[model samples]
Target: IDVGLQTKSNIGKQEAADRAVVNLETRYQIMNMVKDFVRNPANKNQMIPFDADSTSASASIKAYNELVAERIKLGSSAKDNNQALQALDTQIAAMHNNVVSGVENAMRAMRIQINQVNQMSANAGSAMSAIPTEEREARALYRQQGIQNTLYTFLLQKREENALVLAATTPKGKIVDHAYAQSHPIKPKPMMVLFLALVMGLLLPLLLLSVKKLLTTKFSTQDELAEIIQAPVIGEICHNRHKSQLVVKPGKTSSIVELFRLVRNNLQFLLTNDGDKVLLVTSSVSGEGKSFVSANLAASFALLDKKVALVGMDIRSPRLAEMLELQSLPGVTAYLAKPGMNLSDIVQSSAEVSGLDVFVAGAVPPNPSELLLSSRVNDFIDQLRAHYDMIVIDSAPIAMVSDTFSLAKFSDAVLFVTRANYTKRNLMNYLNTVMSRGQLKNVSVVVNDTNPNVSTGYGYGYGEE
Candidate 1:
């Protein structure tokens, strides 16, 4: 609104300035015409020059009076009307008439010039008067434009304010009443909460159990293994309760130990009559108890009065010495490192089983892969092959390292070990790769750490007694 008023005022000022310019132009034109008339050569003599001190009519009258005075003097002096006096009188009258005519002509010319100047001034005035009309029209136009601009600006400002108000003001719903808590407690309904929690407790596990059953890819039964690999599952070893690696004892009987005995019995059918059977026991990954299974299986075979050498081929992380509780040095790595070291010196006897000989991973070598791939390992296996009836090489996991693939060449059979809940279904891809590549001979899976209650088919009816 203020801007509108200011705009109207500015427009009015602009109109006034225009009217002033027009008036000034009109005055300028009048002055120019007056100057032209005054300077015109044709009207130069016609323009009368007036003097306050000297009047033309007065001067002429004074000359006529002087002539009459002279004539009177001459007449008084002469006896009769002489020719000189008449002539003088005639000359005086003619001169007076000429002076009057000249004065009249000069007055007439000045009047005409004055009239021309007046006409020019009138034209200038007329033109100047027209400026007022134009000024009114221009002012009206300016006022209209200003009004439009002001209205537009005002509307825009109002709209912006409305928008700001709309943006700033959040619409709150009508409140019926303010909320206040009751004197008594509303929550802590133990029975209701316990009911819902009980329902959730029951439903949640069932839902998760269904999902796990549907999504499980790991072998839960020996049938699943047989279907996938088309190989005989020599044994399903139950999870050991004891922390010791050698779960099998001489006269001790347990479900886990009996499972190893069952594995030893199943392994007899897979072996060839080729003197010493080299069995490479490995798994897809570590902690699946390949070393444990190898140690126990070697012990199981030893219990049957068969000579068995459990060689720790996992040179990267040698755990057999820890498992067997024997000296790890002067084992495989030591025998390989020193050229003159005897195999008998590095071979240690396990007190757990009489016929079971344990060769631990001597020391961790930087080049374990290269050491496993060397011909010396094959020669060492051959030396052990001549002595031991069964050579159980506890090699590194096939999925983890390439050391197992190299050791698989010296083995007549590969016992691929996998845990029940620990191994995932994706690990089958590694086994499939090993089988497809023929990296291991006669590869068969021994699903270790089997829960007998979960999978009753492979439980062999052994229980904790």
Candidate 2:
């Protein structure tokens, strides 16, 4: 009964809303017709009359048309300044206002009816929805109660069956076989424990070594560096226990000095041509013994009485002067900044190496990269070529700065130095990238600071002091 009443109310309200919409459209059309006749009543169409409709707006238009016709007739008989004509104008304006007001009132009434119908329809819909909602909730509650009762009955049946089984009992029997100890014990097998311990003891160091090798990211041995770089390792200089910069002195016969001698001989084979004199020494980063290599390599050449000039081109970080215990000023920076300055004024002869000359980095410059790009650098290399048999430039690190690339064009060969266990594997990959890109030419690697014990194992102990 409740649902039926709500449905009837919804249907009635919906029909009312439809009627209100139709009335609104009719009123809107009538209002337009009245407004047109009032605005220009003289041009009224005879075929489609505004007064044909039964709406109040249609009656208003008919009255307005009569007033217009009356005004036209009175104007033909009266003067322009007559009082009757003025009164007629006033009447026409009042009637025009009345027609507009009637239209607004009709539209406003239609809108109110529409709003009321919509409210009633919404209320009826809500009422219609509640009946079904309550019925569904009641049905759901009944279904849930049935499910609970069924579940309880099933649980009680299972419990009763279990109780009956527990109350009843079967006949007891004696043990057919008894537990006994076996001849061989299951635990504490001395042979197996000892075997396992022996196996672990044998494999532990190997496992640890394998793990250490896998975790190590830097080059620790000569074979490791060579296998990864795939480049010629021209020399492997041993770790200098004395920590001297000039390990290749004329009279020194230690392992470090002999290694430098080997490097000097290898370079001789690599740079066979006389013009292969400009050797640029650099590394992936700083502290890889590049300065040490550069200074010592030049000194080794000097021992052969070859005129050698070791130039410090790492102007950003001048280490040659400090390593060689020479003054930093009036060297490369001074020579390049002042074109008129003589090369002799900046070049200083090493006291230790009689035939070798040292061109210090002078001072740290604000624009070292730009300075290396100058044409004077090439000219400096050319001048050194004319005077010396060998020119070794200790330039900036290739990875850390672009200054080395700028100076690389002036080199005949590049000696890349990487310290043992100090240079990362990724940097070696970067070197490969550099080589693959052909950014450098005639490149060779020199592994510095290798363990002396490891070197002796490589059969290079013949010259050890």
In TM-score terms, which candidate is top? 2
Displacement of the residue 20 alpha carbon in candidate 1, Å: 98
lDDT of 2 by residue, 268-378 (tens): 888988688999999999989999989998999999989999999999888988888888787898778778877899998988878999999897877777777777887
Task: Give model 1's TM-score versus the native structure.
Answer: 0.53
Clashing residue pairs in candidate 1 are none
**lDDT per residue as tens, model 1, 314-408:** 99978999888898788898788777887888988888789988999988987887777777887798799888988898988877888888777
Collision pairs in model 2? none
Q: Write down the TM-score of every candidate.
A: 0.53, 0.57
lDDT of each: 0.71, 0.77
- Residue 318 lDDT in model 1? 83
